[model samples]
Each structure stands twice: as structure tokens, then as C-alpha cells.
Target: MSASVAASASARAEGGKPRGANYARHYWAFAAPAAAVVGAVIVFPWLFTLFMSVHDWKVTGTVSYVGLANYTHLFTDDRFQWAVLRTLYFTLFATLAPVVLGVIAAVCFAQKFPLRGLARTIFILPMMATPVAVSLVWTMMFHPQLGVLNYILTSIGLPPATWVYQANTVIPTLVMVETWQWTPLVMLIVLGGLASLPTDPYEAAVLDGANPWQTFRHITLPLLWPFILVAAVLRLIDALKAFDTIYVITGGGPGTSSETINILLYQTAFAYYDLGYGSAMVVVFFVLILLISMILLRVRTSR
Candidate 1:
């Protein structure tokens, strides 16, 4: 036993490689429980969803195997195709608006001011508020005749616009509401990144007589790209999965005009009782999100 132990110790010290491998193995052992939990909660559900997607699950008929039929059907389905377009449209504005506004807000808040803390707290309040409550409040504000927004517009001698009432304006109006609620979250993320950034560049830029814009362009933005990308990824995901706000605000519009993939999924699954179709939609949606994520990840890591 002593000879064997000596041989093992000698092997460990040869490159100190075995020790690292052992540590990694031990670490994995410790992590296994959490991994299992995650697999059970998230992975399994998605696997089941994939399984359901390939079947014709119905209330009355026996579940029938459909292979990739549902996915093929999605490509040809007009309503689903339209929802895809609408979702992409909403996502574009919703993601970009918040990120742009958030970066501006982060830059502003990062500077020292008298009431900075209080102001930041107030600014982030919308993000912390309950989604349902926020939707309800906005719903009241969207009321054309009684809404304070219309009152303000009319007082300013502008036309009182249909906020979420008109099909043409509903998606943009919802995007506006989304931007208000989420901009602070992106601001906070960017702020954290800004705080951690090395000050050497900025100090050097100041000594070099670079203006605020020049300094930001040369120093701040390059370093901040990673954080901004992270925020964009988060916002993209949130915007794609957005249902609560739209559901409460427009319930998918003056028709299907404002309907997104998420709304369509819900309507198909629950309202229409087409579980298999809904599952297929979910699968396609997941794949789309995964593709976007990969693209973003590539952009984030690339020079």
C-alpha cells in the first residue's frame, strides 16, 4: 500500500497535471447536484417540448407522430409567418431603444452629481415595479379620452393620438412602454461595467485634450462594448419573450396586428387547444433565439 501511494504521489508531481484533473473531477462532483436540478427544471421541459412538437396532441384524437411536419407547416403558415415578422419588428425597436437610452442614462448617472443616488433610485423604480401593475397603469394612460397623455398632448395643441388603440400605432406604443420599464435595467448593467473600467484611458485622454465625445469614442465605448452586448442579449431575449405587457396593454391589438410569437403560442396552445402546434412554435422560437444568441456571442468575442 505504501509503495502504491508513493507511486501515485510521484505521478501527481510529474506535471502537477493529475492534481488539476482530480480537482476538476471533484469540482464536477460538487456541481452535479445543481446540474441535475437545472436539467430537471429547464432541460427536461425543453426536451419534452421538443417531443410534443413532433406529435399531433389533441383533446380527442390519439397523439399521432408528425416528425418535422409541424416545423414545415410553420414555414408555410401565414398567421405564424406574420407573427414572426411582427415579433421581429417589435423586438428590433424594443431592444435598440432601451440599450441606446440605457447607455446614455448610464453615462449620465456615472458622473457625480448632488442627488445622484436618489435620482438613480427613482429612475430604476419602473424596473422594480410589478409588471402587471405597470401594465395596468399604462393601460389607463393609453385610454384616449381620459388618459393624461392625451390631455398633455391636447394642452400642447397637438393632435390626441391613439396610443394602443390603433393597429398602426399599437406595437410602437407597446415598445415605448417596454423601453421605459427596461431602460433602467440596461443602465444598471452598463453602469456596473463603467465602474469597473480602468481610469487610465480617460485620464490619458483628458491629458491629450480629447473632448467628451472624443474621449468616449476612443476610451469608454471600446471597453464598454462587452457590457453593452450583454445588455443587448438580455433585452433581445426579454423582448422576444414579451407577453405580459402586450397581453395586458393590447391583448394582441385591434386584430392580430400586434400579435407576437409569444402571444400566438399562448393563443394556439391554450385558447385554441392546439398543444402540438404550440409546442412546435415554441421549438422554432427557441431555435431563433439560440441563433441570435450565437450571433451576439460571436460579435461580443470577435475583434
Candidate 2:
């Protein structure tokens, strides 16, 4: 009986009935393709960028080793310094504006109102549109003389100021454009969180004689903190990497006034043909993004 049982177990094991180790092997086989895809698409490029950051590689010639020269040069370069500062400024304004507006929009949309569905679709349309197309349309609207914006100002008996011509206004204009495009994304995220919230706390607050403002401030805000953090982090990272709209609208114009880090990297790589330096900038930007994300994650997790 023992011999027969041993033979049966061996047959079952060999006939696709996986043992413990074999199960693990099969599981890895199922996971390997996804892991390889992620590594190839994401990890490999990141590692390559890091490697290139420490070298002086030209587009046409042999690569030379440059220890920390690229990083040091970036610090000293006036254009790069300006780009970094401008990037931070953009991130701050872009992130805050959208988050604030998104919360308001979410609150408004959370209530049942007439044509609410249509209103949401309209609000989110800009985010779905092609960025390049939006940029082109805005560029026309921002034209100094004949643009719709200037025309409106003139009609109101106000002088038409150059919107994108001056360095001071260019960054703000870009921020406005970014905010217009991304606020809906924040709204959607916040709305989801709001929808998921339990009604009991709100009811209890009402019963406790809490006013609307008090309930929102004390209960809703705290409960929605995680979603807010998530939206802010996403917006921050995206704003840091903003390029297409600004590139199309300003082209980092008026003497690089609105140039973000991504724009700087693009100029370095393509216009200046300094592949190695550009790659180093990319590496620095990547590290900064990773650090910021980690910090945000830590804060969220702790809470």
C-alpha cells in the first residue's frame, strides 16, 4: 500500500500537479513577462540616463569621461540656474492653483444639480484635447495686438499689455494655461474621494450643530487629505516636467524667461547638441522627482 501511494504521488507531481517549488517556478513564469516589460521600458532607460550623466558624450564623436563636471557646470550656467528656479516657480503656482480649484469644483459637482453630468464633461474636455492644439489656440489668443484677449481689454477701455512678450508675464501665463488644463484632473480625483466618503460623519456633524463650513474644514478636509496629497504630488511632478504647451506657446522665448528644466534639457540635447550634458540634466531632474515623490509618500503614509 505504501509503495502504491508513493508511485501515485510521483505520477501526480509529474503530471502537471505542481509541488511547492514547482508552483513558485510557475508563478515566476507568469510574472516574468510583465517584469521584463517594465524593466525594458522604464528601468533600463533610467539606468542609461544615470550612466550617461557622468560622461561627456557627443552626438557625433566618442564619449569621454567627465566626473562631476556636468553637474558643476549646470550650477554655474546662468541659463540652467534660471531654468531650475523657473521650474520651481511653475511647480508651486501650477500645483497650488489646480488643487485649490479642484477642491472647489469637486464640492460644487458633488451636489446634485441640473446638467451636472454635462458640466463635468465640459470641464474635463480641455484635459482630453491635444496639448499642441490647445497651445496653438492660446498662442493666437495671446497675440499682442489682434488677439481676443487684447481686443477684449481694448473694448473695455483698458490698454492691451503684451502678454507673452515680457519675461515677467510669460511664466504667469504659462501657469494659467497649465492650471486650466489640469484642474479637471484634480477635480476628478477629489470627486472620487468624496464619493467614497461615508455619510455617517457628515450626518453626525450636522446633528452636533456643526455648520457647513465647520464640517468641511474639520471633517471633510481631514478625510480627503490623502487624495489631496496624491493630486498635489501628481501635479507637482507633471508641472516640473512641463514642456509641450510652454514650448509651443513661448518656445522658452523672450530670452529663456519661461524655460523649465525639461525645456533646458531639450535645448541642450537638440539645439546645443550636447548629449552628455543634457543626459546629466535629465538624471538630476529624475533624482529630484524621485526625492519629492518619496517625501510626499512618506508624509502621506505617516498620516
Candidate 3:
């Protein structure tokens, strides 16, 4: 028996066999595939964008390195500046409206109500709808003369205003469309968090003779802060990068009134055939997004 045990031990040592190594080997194997995919899809594209940003190369020509000239031109360009401002404005309204509406909807649905499931499903429908489809529908609805929205306004004795045709109303119209499309997403996220909350604190609050508003302000809001922040951050990022809806809805018009950065970049690259400048704009936007994400993450972690 001793001889046999010694032989087994010797074989194990010679083979470098260890039980803990199996877990490590398995973990690396699983991680390797994901790491390779991320590097190929995300990392490579990011690096390419960075490299392209510094060069003055057309879509079909010999490439020329221009260092920071593209970035300098971006700063000096008035159209780019206006696009940045418009993008910021859109981001602010788009992020805030949905989050506020969502919280309210989640709060309402958190209580036991008849047809609650159906209502929740209805609310989430818009979120699942394709952006291109939504934009197309909204485009028809924003028609100045015969659109449903203007018709409703006329019927309700309100002024029948030009929506997409006029510069003044374009941004607001886009914001309204965006809010309609994205509020359901915010509602779903907030609803999930609300549903997952423990009931004991709410019960205790009621036992202490707290009213609904008091309970919400003191107990519910504080606990739901993390989820709210997450939703807001997600919405903010998406709003910053908004493209398709704006592209289909306004096409960055009535005379650049609704030209967000993404739209500007698209117009620059494909519309005007300024590939290098457009790539620079994209790189700057990417960096801005990364910085904002980091800041938001830091804030969330701190909380």
C-alpha cells in the first residue's frame, strides 16, 4: 500500500497536476474568447478611430498625416460648435424628461392596481420599437399642415404652429419625439428596481403614521437613487450618441437648427466627403463620452 501511494504521488508531481489549477485553467479558457471578441470588435475600432483622427485622408486616396490639424479645425468651425451645443441641449432634455416620467410611472405601478401587467406592457412597447420605425412614424406626424399633432392642436383651439418646418420648434419637436420613444425604457428600469425593493421599511413607515409622500421622500427615494442614477446615465449616453432618429426626423434641419454632433459628423463624412475631419469629430465625441461615463460611474460608486 505504501509503495503504491508513493508511486501515485510521484506521478502527480511529475505531471504537475493540482486540483486548484483546473479552476484557473477553466476560467482563462472562458475569459479568452470574450477578451478576443472585445479586442477585435471594440478595441480595434477605437484604435482605428484614434489613428484616423490624426490624418487628412479622403475615403479613396493616399493617406496624409496631419497631426492635430483636424482637431484644430473642429474647434474653429462654427458649425461644429453649434452642433456641440445642440447635442448638449438634446442630451439634457432627453435624459431628464424620461427619467422624471419613468420614476412617476414606476411609483404609480408599484402599487397593486388592476390591469397593472397590461399597463406595464403597453408602456414598454415603445422602447422595444425600432428607432428607424419610430422616427418614420414621427416624421409623418410632424407634417406642418395635415399632421395629427397639428390637427389636434387646431381642434383644441390652440395655435396650429409649424413644427418641423420652422427652426424654433424643431429642437422641441425632436425632444418630444425622443421623450415619447425612450420614457418606456426608463420606466422599465425604474420599475424593476421598485419591484425588487423590500417591503419592510414601507410597512414600518406606515406603522409610524407616515403619509405616502413622507414615506416616498424619506424612504423610497433614497433607496431608489442608485437605480435612478443608472437609468439617467444610460439615457444620457444614448442621447449624446443619438443619430438615426434625428437623421430620419429632421435630417439636421430646418437649417441646422437640430444638428447634433452625430448628425454633423455624418454630414461631414458622407454628405460632404470630409472623412478625416469627420473621423476627428468622432474621436473627440468618443473621448467626451468616455469621460462622462467615467465621471458618472465614479459618482454612482461614491453613492
Candidate 4:
């Protein structure tokens, strides 16, 4: 670094700014390709979605400008409204479940124990697996009659119930699957936070005669709160846009009982071939998520 800078300095002293000019050119030269890819993929798709939102587009019909007609019809549609509600409902539980369980698991794993490393590795294995593969396995485990989960329940004098098949249990069951898969991620994040925490606070608290629970409550929880919120925000976004696991497990089954916005959008765009309406739904969902993110950010900053 010093040699390069000295060369540039000598070049400038020799009455030439070519070295600095070349530096700037090289920087942008390295950056331009990535910028171009981003524009082509991310920016272009978003622009297209926005454009289609205003047009009467469909699979087999002539695309025509429709202004806000698609958006208007989307809001008034009962199915879309229900799907939005379901998405929010799903997001709340799914986000909370992982965060809460993750915190507990992280706290436990942070402490010294026999075979602690092995246990943590085992715990995080589910998170390492692919979501689709996990969902497929859980699908069979959710089987009412012969599944291992039901067998264990029945052996414990509990009745085996159809999990993903039932309307009322469908969403919660899916949330459980999400929680099981993602809790370790939350754990990993919280564990990082925990590891970075200052020991002096805990030492002072202990010297101040604070009990274990009291020390953790007064020192640990407060410091950990920000990290928890980080995990919450990410989990909230993921849950809102969740599709793969839910699609594989329930397929929005039991008569749309567990359908969220993503599933609804897929069905609208592809199944119904209503591209314009689907695009409108995408725009609306995007706006809804944006509002939610802004609200979350406001709350986080306010705190």
C-alpha cells in the first residue's frame, strides 16, 4: 500500500495527475460490471412489476393500460384481503416463535456444559438442511396414523391428530415447522451477541449480590434486546414472504385455510392466469411490507 501511494505521489510531483485519474477509473471499472448486473436483474424486474401493475395483462389477452383499475379491484377482492390478513397473522406467530425459542436456546448454549459443542451442532443441523427437504420430511412426520411423532404422542397417552390436514391446526402446525427450522438461526445470532457481551457487567452484578436470574434480567436481557430485535426484523420479513416450506407442507391446503399472500399471489398469477391482477397484488404486498418495515424501524429507533 505504501509503495503504491508513494508511486502515485511521485507521479503527481512529476507534473502528472494520470496516477489519480487511473485510480478513479480502475475503481469504477471494477464496480461497473456488478452495477450492471444489479440493474439488469433486480431493478429491471421491479420496474416490470410496477409497469404490469397498471396494465390489464393476462396470459392470453391483449395487454392494455388500465391505470389504477387493477389496484382498486385487488383491494376490494375478498380473497386478497383474507390473504393479507393471513399473511400478517402468520408473520406475527412465525417471527415470535423463532425469536423466543432462539433466545432460550442461545442462553443455554452460551453456558459451559458437558458435550455442549456437540449438542449445539446437533441442534443446528436442522437449520443447515434445505428448507424444502426439511418440509418434505416434516410432511411425513405430520402424517396422522403411522408417523413417528404421532407414535410418540400415542405412547405418552396423547391422541394422534392430523396435523397439516386440519383447517384450524394448519397454520399453527406450519408455524411450528418454521420455528423448529429457524429457531437455531435466531440462536446463532443471539449467541454472537451473548459472546460479545462485556463480562464486567456480570462480574459487578455478581459482586453486588445479584442472583443468577436477576443478573441476567438486569444486565443480559437489556444488552441482548438489540440483537433480538435484529433477528426479529429478519424473521418478520422472511415469514411475510414465506413460500417454499408452506408450499411443500400444506400447499395452502384444507381449502385455503393456511394461505398467505405469497401462495395467493402464485395462485393468482399462474393458476388463474390473471397476470395483471397478480402484478397488482405484488405491488400492494410490497407496499404493505414496506409500511411494516418502516413501522418496525421507527419502533426500533424510538426504543
Best by TM-score: 1
The pairs that clash in candidate 3 are none
User: What is the TM-score of candidate 4?
Assistant: 0.90
Better of 3 and 4 by lDDT: 4
Give the alpha carbon lDDT tens digit for every residue of 1-303 in model 3. 999989878877887975456688678887898999999999998888888889997878868999999999998999999998998888999989999998999899888989999988888888789999988988888888879989999999999878888988888778888888888888888888998889999899989999989999999999999899989999999999988899998899989999999999998889878788888999889888888878998999997
Q: What local lDDT does model 4 show for residue 82?
A: 87
Kindly report which residue stretches of model 3 are placed more than 4 angstroms away from their true locations once superposed.
Answer: 1-22
Q: In lDDT terms, which candidate is top?
A: 1
- What clash count goes with each model? 0, 0, 0, 0
lDDT of 4 by residue, 1-303 (tens): 999989878878896656556678678878899999999999999999999989999899789999999988976889888888888888999999999999999999999999999999999998899999989999999888878999999999998877998988898898999898889989999999999999999889978999989988899999999899888888888899999999999889889898999999999899989888899899889988888887888888899
Higher-ranked by TM-score: 1 or 4: 1
Model 4: lDDT to the true structure: 0.90
Which pairs clash (backbone N, Cα, C closer than 3 Å) in model 2?
none
Instruction: Give the Cα error of residue 67 in candidate 4, in Å.
Output: 0.9
For each of the candidates, the C-alpha root-mean-square deviation to the true structure, in angstroms, is 5.7, 7.1, 6.9, 4.3
lDDT of 3: 0.89
Q: Residues 1-303, candidate 1: write the lDDT tens digits.
A: 999999999988896677767577678888899999999999999999999999998756769999999889999999999999999999999999999999999999999999999999999999999998899999999899999999999999999999888889999999999999999999999999999999888889989999999999888999999999999999999999999999888888789999999999999998988989899999999999999888989988885
Q: Please state the error at residue 47 of candidate 3 in Å.
A: 0.8
Off by over 4 Å in 4: 1-26
lDDT of 2 by residue, 1-303 (tens): 999989878987788763665577578888899999999999999888878888998888879899889989888989888888899998999999999999999999999999999999999998999999999999999999779999999999999978888999998899999999999999999999999999999999989999999999999999999999999999989999898999999999888888889998998999988888998899888888889889989999998
